[model samples]
Target: MRILVVEDQDSIRRMIEALVQARGYEVTAVSSGAKALDVILTAPHDLVLLDLMLPGQYDGFEVCRRLRADPSTRAIPVFIISAMDDPESRRKATEAGANAFYTKPFSPIALLKEIERLTTGKG
Candidate 1:
């Protein structure tokens, strides 16, 4: 499956990319939500792992909203990855149309499991 990871932190982004690549999935990693949008618009991705704190006009929430608003991408699965560990943050992510919410310091295996479930129609 093809996945897109939008994370600003270089180390974290590379870590996620390595983990996902190890899972035998093709991944496209970008540092900002805007770049993510550009790629999403140009090609198809099975799923998206988005960071809430982004370095652009659109945060992950806004990016998720925009994706959901677009007809072509509205059905794509999105998982919000953030360090904002609060009930409100989770609620906002769901409201913004994220399929799942994962906080920072997350388990790479668990995250991959969730991604598999979402993409495979098991979650």
Candidate 2:
């Protein structure tokens, strides 16, 4: 499975990349939402692990919305992982058509398991 991880934090991005790589999945990690959109537009990813807050004008929410709006990419699975652990954040995720929402300080194994379920149809 190919997973695209969008995280602004270097450490966190590298950590998630390593974790996903260990799971035997192809990973393409990007530091900003703009870069994510660029890659996402160019090719299809099996799953997208997106962070809510980003450094660009288009944050994860916007990215998610665009993905959902585009007929070609509307059905792609999006998982929102963010430090903004608020009701509003979760609401925004749902509005943007995210398949799952995860807060920061999340369990690595749990994330992996959920990714497995989404991509492979089994956890």
Stretches of model 2 off by over 4 angstroms after superposition: none
- lDDT, candidate 2, 1-123, per-residue tens: 799999999999999999999989999999898999899889889999999899978899999999899898887899999999999889989998999988989999999988988887884
Question: In terms of lDDT, which candidate is strongest?
Answer: 1
Candidate 1 structure quality by residue, lDDT tens digits, 78-116: 999999989988999999999999898999889999999
Against the true structure, whose TM-score is highest?
1
In candidate 1, list every pair of residues with a backbone clash.
none
Q: Give the TM-score of candidate 1.
A: 0.97
